[model samples]
Target chain A: MDYSGNGKQFSGKVVTVTSGKGGVGKTTLTANLAAALAADGQKVVCIDGDIGLRNLDVVLGLENRIVYDLVDVVEGRCRLRQAMIRDKRLPELYLIPAAQTRDKNAVSPSDMIRLTNELRPEMDWILIDSPAGIERGFRNAIAPADIVLVVTNPEVSAVRDADRIIGLIEAEEKGPARLVINRIKPAMVKRGEMLSMEDVLELLAIELIGLIPDDEGVVTSSNRGNPIAIEGKSKAAQSFRNIAQRLQGHKVPFLELQEDGNLFGRLARLLRPGGN
Target chain B: MHAVLIKPGTDRNGMEISTKFQIKGIREGLLVTLGDAPWEQVYAALIEHLDEQRDFLKGARLALDVGNHMLKAADLGQIRNQISERDLTLWAVISNSPTTERTAQTLGLETRLSKPKPEPAAQDTRYQDGDPAILVHRTLRSGYSLQNPGHVVILGDVNPGAEIISGGDVIVWGRLRGMVHAGAGGNESAVICALDLAPTQLRIAGVIAITPQRRGKSQPEMVRILNGQVVAEPWNPKKKD
Candidate 1:
């Protein structure tokens, strides 16, 4: 079967995006990162390793057109070219969708390795969207990742899961994983209702890459099958782009939207003066 | 080629087809390499070999190296099932092809023999390289045993049935409720500190200490080698200096 090598490179390296918790924006990051990288002229293919709960296709807006998936290619039922759903907007970007019917057991870690190894020769980056949980899906996604970006939010459960995932990653000899804190609510953080960046960092204690604030636009865009990162104006979009740029070896600054959530909230309150 | 390759009875030849397979211990586990021919022949030969030397290889960890025949999960699973039927654990299957490797992995088998990890931290500690320690930042789940020949600084909880073995010291930033072995390399100076130090059993150097039924208020405590014994004491900010 024609397994296309990773369509992007960094000093010719493929990086995979992963998270330990379910529904913690792994797909969102993978889709946006691929789009952002492709926008910068890097050939990228985001492989959704979350087979059963495959949402990369949906988030990337390639859901309706998916005919074959990673399992199909791995099982040799379809050619890899037949499975890769090229992005409508980006000429260089691609999406290797995951099968929605099958569970994580459908593909093995080595199948992913073979697939990624084949893709490594062709692409600039093979950004695999790892499924949540520190199980088989996680292993498959990380098996061939030259770099793993562990995504999390500023929440206790998410941070705990991230820590576990990081430990498992290190145990597998698969990390030195970088961190991406997603969907952090600045206002809640300030009032002590949410975990601040320091609180999350104290628990994770990893090199921070991107700080994406909570954006309602992400929901609307996903509903329209458009990833927010593809839209240039949105804040979350900018976050994904910066992450992609950093992955390309650019020294991008982490967004300092809020130093401590309370300060930002206090400033907002002062500016508003309780008019509404 | 098959006829010529086979040794006649027990006589001298290039390789003996009739010869019993050898099961010897390698660093990883029992290395069992089947002769290349048909899988049926190899399977039968392995069982026969096991039967003959049942006493010698009982309850041993095994790793089978099946050279380049793309085995599906069921094929590898069957081998493991057969091995388990004989009370042997098949821990790994070393393969050359990606397909075989995938199958082995799908069957939850190790792709490589467990090579002894280079004890970098341990080596660093032995040289007294500025309080060498390994830091962990996750919950140690059940059945997880971390053996560091240096100090261990954990940023999370150590659950029951988990173990931490350190040569120098062990510190849990979170609660510690596991079996811990400090002074693992027999160094008596090792100590263990935890937010709530209620361990199933704690050992330091040659001394073993039990938690005193955990009656009092929970506090950050340190267990150290005091008066030639391991003692648990309330951690004091002013005591160390």
Candidate 2:
């Protein structure tokens, strides 16, 4: 099973943000990636693949506005158009909110593929937030994905989960998966309390796409339903924005995550015009 | 005396000609098709062809592709004994004519090509293009397997659980701690080498070796079949100089 990175150009690209372990920020990356892609004027749709415990609505600040969930649309109770909850802020951004009442078995891989093919003609990106573990939900998430991005934190346990995910992805022929090491704490790494980027890269041995440092603003922004990439500036926001740009085919240099406050300057961060 | 066996004007002298190309090599260490002519001339041409490609045809896998020549197993066995006198093997008889094929099968001669052509990697321009094998310039991790019929030279490590099964030699620039089988078709001369010669299992031709744990650090090592057993020794291409 080998997935060549061949389907990245044109049409709607499905990037499944998956991690094998829970609480490793799969939803955060999904929510932010959706926002990041939409912020660039590309029409984007985020499918919350965690069927029973959906969070794309809450993360994208559309929880109260959800009229119908993914299962309703999949089971044909409602039109496919009725289930998509559009974000008011970003005209190009939409969310096909997950079903809370039912489990992941509510949608199948074929169903996901059909849904994605329908969305393909209208959108530029469809980011699937895959549920944790190598189960049916994970299979459904990656079923329609053109590129699989394995997200993990810079910790031993998170890395183990990522390795397992990478193995599974390769077996599905859905990979040569790229890695996104999220929630990297530079200070902890410097103090040797956390795993370094090199250590994680060594074990994973996959091409790293982005390294997002742990930021306090991420939680507050999630609480308010606006991703940090669009709001108050942080290294993490720039990281996500750079990732979005990279997804759009721009090659961006990696940001050096250093927290010693020393004279050695970090790589230039691309500050967008929206905010500081 | 034998002028009547000739077709009138074609050769008044009645001199026989066996001019078609003969691939008289062993199919599985057996002398297969020698040139097929009229029965007596066919045997004569076979003897002559054996004398010409003497060194190149030595000890090869051979099968005879006799076109419509029907002969009893005793007759074929007699010819085989003759070839065996010269250390040639008669393995298979490939024949379009049913009688000969049946006879060859009865004599236990293989009748078909071994297998279909090997399937190379997808997205490999070299798979369809002329390059037989491509150089992989990185380490092969666990669960990563490479299947190439041509020689495979890796510039990095082959970790445990990884495999490199090649139809030719496999040379690893770094540590080789994985399973590697070279000359997979039983070519005994194929050699495997690495900076740290510590494979979970090493195979060359029909011989296999398990690298014993060394007490000291790793050194460059090479493995080859010696006296019909796989043996690994220190690799020092420069130490001799």
Candidate 3:
């Protein structure tokens, strides 16, 4: 569990969480994963790659304390350490918020590479929160990633966009990217009303890292500027912590989300004996 | 004309600027062919040339023919931004390098200057006798496209959102779920066949058809123009056409 670097030759692994479709819970997942890793005693820093529409700071509840942003570091207006705001709860966790006033074109891919290279020496893990779409911002977020995690909802459109993003990643030689299915509703999936995890994995053909069930507490905790991974014991929080453990080369079993239906449905299934 | 010749002579640093590029007007817009120099030098010269002719080349749809330059996504993306800053739309990028072509396609830029050419006239017996075919061994994922003048034989799955446009027949040894246009050049004799013939859309010459959903497990099927309508039937060895 100790990923801390030795006294010399210490470099962190950069993991970027990206979803081609918007509002698929990328910022939420990034915040929770950072919190989970930091809670595990690993030094983690999260970068908000979405410039004009920054949300990672707000999600992590470090919005008001941010004196400098990522653009300031890239443009040499502020030192790299000056822009990183340490979390109040987890002393090991830090966040480098995006510039709200600048657009995506403000930072180039090489700038991102340089910035992450500067942060690699001191941290155990660096996670980048990528914006939606396969544009400049997405490219910048993924430029320096040692691992890419693609998040997608089980809907057809989101899966389609994820497919496109996976293809692009392959073309850039950044793959094979891992899959993280967020906001999954097991009840609807069991009723044939939504796409199952198998359906998504069949199309994407990538390794699965985590399956996070839908939880309302996730939204409330995010709104309260506290990540669920640190504050709540919800399934979504456990899912994020499991993913962090997996990233650290630990073997964690995937959660059995299908058994999370209503009590009556579970009893009926148990009585029916092998009746799906 | 002579005054324009001296424009690309030398910079203030006394560095000889080799701004060798040819600009031609095409149906789409301007096609700029850059010479084989170092990427940095050529890029700087191209930008300088554009800036010099700002009024003339402004608002033009440009297709750059970068000869054999193995450009990556970062390189292509940078040039795209530079091109856009000069008020030009970079729609396509023509390159001899496969890596560069794939990079351009991933960025949603066109790799070919024109669509697949129409088939030659019926009287041209030479072309009919020697129709070429290209064999692809890898799976064609989403957002990837394959366009050929002759037949296209794929040994892998054609996922949805991918496409194939061929002048001759199209055959897939694996599952086919993408769009396939056989007889793209008005050859109605072209046939499309696959182990799983569930394509997003199928076309033969000028006609297009959507494959009806299958009831049971999929079987090998072939689609062709039957009486001016596109029809698909299971491939039966003993049955006569």
Candidate 4:
């Protein structure tokens, strides 16, 4: 809660999570990643860049603590500290909720650059949850990012939109973006009814950072406004934590996500630990 | 009636639009340089000048050099509509500010004008012969477009949403998965060749064709107009057409 360590000069790395298609897990990943990083004792801040359609605060379980939003800080209506709401559980984590009534055009890309620049020196990580299109909101979120994480589902349409988003990020010189495939069903993939990790990776041709399996715990946790990465022992939670470790420059192997509970599967898991 | 005389030594008589606007002839029609006035005053002067020389400026391609004025998308969109209504095409918008350039790009307007290059002799003699072709070495990602008056050769993949439009032949050394149009200026003899020829849509001259899903591994293929129908043939080195 105390941000008065101005003498410590820790410039934070800004990471923006964006997906071109709506209903992708951009907000969810941002919330969990911030929580996981904060749980590791790293000071992190999450900014909801989707102005008119804010969801990061709700996903982070900090919707009730909103005193001032992003637009209030950008438009100079409030100071930066007043708009940042600290998480109840993790003292190192903060949330800057978006203004629900204001549209995307209310905030410009330069304003986002200026805002993140002000927050860069105090925190260890600044995560921006981008809106679902390649328009003003997406541009605003990526303008200040040192790294961009493109989240996508395993479906064809989501992958197509993710391709477009990756191209746009490359065009804006913020690429090449790391990929995080969410809501993947390993059972369906095994049955050849869904896209496997290899298929998505071949099409996207980007570096893979995280591969999250489809879990019902994610939905339940979201409804309860608690991130699954905080305490849950689900595979999805472990994937988020592994991604955080990867972002921190640790070499963590990808999790093997096959749901076959046979002896061979268990032996394979033992043979190649964290092998995909 | 104040007779605004066009300046001498210029090829076009509509060279001088006004004091605030300087219009000159370039390879791509007219290039207008706007003065360092406020947005409203400059816009007013531009519209007035365009209206005054309506006859001579009709159907002309214009490239506006807007000095450090940081105009938004709405401002650029309004001026583009106005120019289009006056029968003048605004092909490019040159700006000193990065914000304005990005706004222009988002509106699908070119921000830079390529310098005029020497025309190849084959372009004037025969359309099928070797013409000056541009070589792009990088992958054309989605939302990126490459258009040329001659031929285009890409050494990388053309992803799903990218596009390539050429007046002559189109050749891809790598996969061609996006939309491509060859002989866009109505030359049917133009052909498109790719290592893996699976495009969302392909057009040559006035004919359009879509590739069906390949059952197995893809091979190098060539597509062209054969007997008034677009046909794809395997690129055989020994076979001569």
Candidate 5:
């Protein structure tokens, strides 16, 4: 929350979280990853880039403290620091809520770039929660990122959209985007009703960053306006933590998808070129 | 946004009325050849044509043949962006001016038309090779379409929603799951072949066919018009006698 972290000499990195389809857990992943990174002693800020459909503040439980939002900052109605809502739980985490009244045209891609440039010298990570669909909103979110994480589900529709989004990212020269498969049900996959991880990876052909299981704890924590990464021991929470660690350049092995697959299975899969 | 200018000599309500631009169906999509006039006037005429033919031109890939027009980067970029807003993709720009060609290249636009021409004779004056086909080396994802006047050869996968239309034969060295049209200029003998032929739709001249569900594993298949009907057969090198 310190905007004046001068003399530290560490430039912050921008990471954009985007999904081509709606209701695909982009906001959940953003909130949890921001929380996990902050807990790991990295100063992080989450920018809600959904414009009129802003929900990052609500999910982060910082809705009540918002006096200014992204539109206010871009329109020069408030300073960058004045619009950032510092979290009450984690001292290092902050939230920049979006304006609920204006549409995506209220902000431009250059505005996001300039704002991130101003915040780059002070923080460790700047996370932008991109809106669904490939429009001006999506372009605004990705214009300022050093890395992009494309979130998708295991369904055919989600993978199809992810492929299109990946193609667009590559066209913009911002790819290859990393993939994070969320809300995966291992039981359904075993029953031949869902797409396996290998199927998704084969089609996407991108680096696999994280796999989040379907956990009811995510809904419960969201109802209470708290990310599970900050207060739970669920497998989903652990996966988000691992993603945060991977983002920090750590060599963390992927967690086994099956219930009985142990460390040896994971290690063997890693050793083989196309094992799983 | 201007009122369309119909060519003189035809009836006002006639469907055969001409404009300042000529649009012909090509393998790649629709090729729009502009008349030699002021660039601004030609651009305005083109927009009016697209607006008047919006229903017929929706979702069409367009290649502009701007002859001898020395265009700046900003001008070409603006036109490309405006074309996309109209639900049309301007992929190639054929120009005679080197400056214009360089500008189009800078914008990542294709500057060559698929025309069979002899390569610059390097070693022998009597030997020449005329291959009009272009070998694309990357996967064609959704929303991408390639059109050519000659044969088209692809070395990568063609994902769903991607399209390839060629005036001659079409061949894919990898998976072909998208739509394809060979002999788009009405050559009935044109053939379409793929390593794995599971196209959404296949067209040869006047014929159209959809792929059937496979019984087991995939195999190399060739599709062509046989006895006035589009049919597929397994491609076996040993069967060629």
Candidate 6:
């Protein structure tokens, strides 16, 4: 008795990117993952779940194309397809921008589940950018997720917050969330000034899905409203591409952080002059 | 000790009004008595009342007296789950039916309203017990708080941003890095202990302390207020402080 009338054989996997703390690159990871997935010819839609603080559109460079936002779709002011702003460069990518005026309570968890279900048939992946904190916004973002990617920096505070978020995810039974350690400065970690990948893993015991090194190009590309994963040549872009591959069940080896600043690594750096 | 009675009211058009459940504070948490009506109506009314008083009744233990109602195990289990989802523990089921009592017993609920047992000696602290204690088995996350007027014991890590406020001693079998306040009702002798004690903030009665930055690995530590100041020391059962 398959009573669900929406006769669709395929449904996209909903992945939510969330961090308990603000300024930890949740939006950046969502935008880049969407871009990388779309570049791989997968139809991806990114729903900005940060209501009233919507920036995924700006990060994805689809701000100007948003005629109707998520609030419109939930409020019955427009159709779900009408609010989907398709990416011009990547023909398979789309952005469902959050409403700037309404807050997180404007849409409930059931509403998000319905919206993602409606878009499930036509898409391959739905990436949601969750707002910071363990409140209504985070609940809404994770309600429809098949996988939750916890993005965190290699700092004590961020890792602590990520641990708390992981506990909450497990409490909601959406757990065993995969981890993404973003903005790792290898030089600082080598100097023992910053928390290393192992240190972060020791506290938050979760599977590591991606490790993106600190790159200045990410800032410039985000400023220009373009995701670095689209066509950038930085190691950060390659890391995102590897993450996308891993999401598609590809076994990609993690990038070596190159933290050994000894004579051997120094010689290698000197010979190549631009080694990561 | 007396049974509560309720009379149905009449509407403006002279229609009979449906009587709902009543909630009253008792020595043991709250006593919620269902009215003499259909099971569905009484259950719905009870849920509606609980929802309406949610803010005032969070984390309160409850004793449900479903008078003479011969409810099955499924019915009792469903109500218990609903009450737990509202953060209220249904500790006892005071029923007049032996069938209902057996059903409640199968669900691990007490069939009588006995006085809650006092917790055994916790760590090295003594207490003038008043409020009933609660034992939590899962990790407390950020934005999640456990506030009990009695003692609180946790079996998992208390991550940063989580909080526990208790009137008695606070004990953690795992790491404790969150904020905790023992002796919240001003019992200065209350103590806090954890396997790896490194809380963001710790309070005992009127004393407050922050964990100093550790340069070495963490160990099982206990914290208490000694002379108007909070201090932490390794918990060794063989040695005296």
- lDDT (tens digit, per residue) of candidate 6 on A164-246: 78876775567679999999888776656667787677667689999999999999999889999999998899999989998
What is the per-residue lDDT of model 4 for residues B1-241, given as tens digits with 9 covering 90 to 100? Answer: 2333345222244433353567778777788888786678779878987898899889999999998889887688668757866778898999999779866865667988873232333433236466678888777767777777788999988877889888788999988888998887777888999998878899988899987777556789999999988999998888775
Q: Write the per-residue lDDT of candidate 5 for residues A5-94, one digit (tens) a residue.
A: 345448898899998999999999999999999999899999999999999998899988999999999999999999999998999999
lDDT for every model? 0.74, 0.74, 0.84, 0.83, 0.81, 0.81
User: In model 6, which runs have C-alpha deviations exceeding 4 angstroms?
Assistant: A1-9, A259-276, B1-134, B185-188, B225-229, B236-241
Q: Which of the two, 1 or 5, has more DockQ?
A: 5
**Candidate 3 ranges beyond 4 A from true positions:** A1-9, A260-276, B1-31, B38-62, B70-90, B97-103, B120-130, B236-241
Order the candidates by TM-score, highest first. 3, 4, 5, 6, 1, 2
Give the range where candidate 3 chain A is weakest over 10 consecutive residues by summed lDDT.
A267-276
Model 4 clash pairs are none
lDDT of 3 by residue, A1-276 (tens): 222224534789889999999999999999999999999998999999999999999999999999999999989999999999999899999999999999998898778888999999899889999999988899889889888999999898898889888888876678889999998888876655567787688778889988998999999999989999995877888899999888887889877776643432333333332211
Residue B127 lDDT in candidate 4: 62
Assess candidate 4 and give its TM-score to the true structure: 0.76
Tell me the tens digit of each residue's lDDT in model 1 across A1-276.
111224433333557777777878888888888888899988888899989998888888888999999999999999888888888799889999999999887887767878877877677778898988866687778878778888998887777678767765655556678899988888776655677677566556677888898888977777677777776587778888988888777777766677553444445433432211
Q: Which stretches of candidate 5 lie over 4 Å from their true place?
A: A1-9, A262-276, B1-129, B239-241
| Candidate ranking (lDDT, best to worst) | 3, 4, 6, 5, 1, 2
What does candidate 1's lDDT look like per residue over B106-153, in tens digits?
Answer: 445677776333333343244365877877767674346776666889
Question: lDDT by residue for model 4 over A3-32, one digit each (tens)?
Answer: 213444478888999999999899999999
TM-score comparison, 1 vs 2, better candidate: 1
When 1 and 5 are scored with lDDT, the better candidate is: 5
User: DockQ of each candidate's interface versus the true one?
Assistant: 0.06, 0.02, 0.26, 0.17, 0.14, 0.16
Residue B114 in candidate 4 has what lDDT? 76
Q: lDDT (0-100) at residue A34 of candidate 3?
A: 98
List ranges where model 4 is wrong by over 4 Å: A1-9, A260-276, B1-91, B94-108, B111-130, B238-241
Best by DockQ: 3
The TM-score each candidate achieves on chain A is: 0.89, 0.90, 0.91, 0.91, 0.91, 0.91
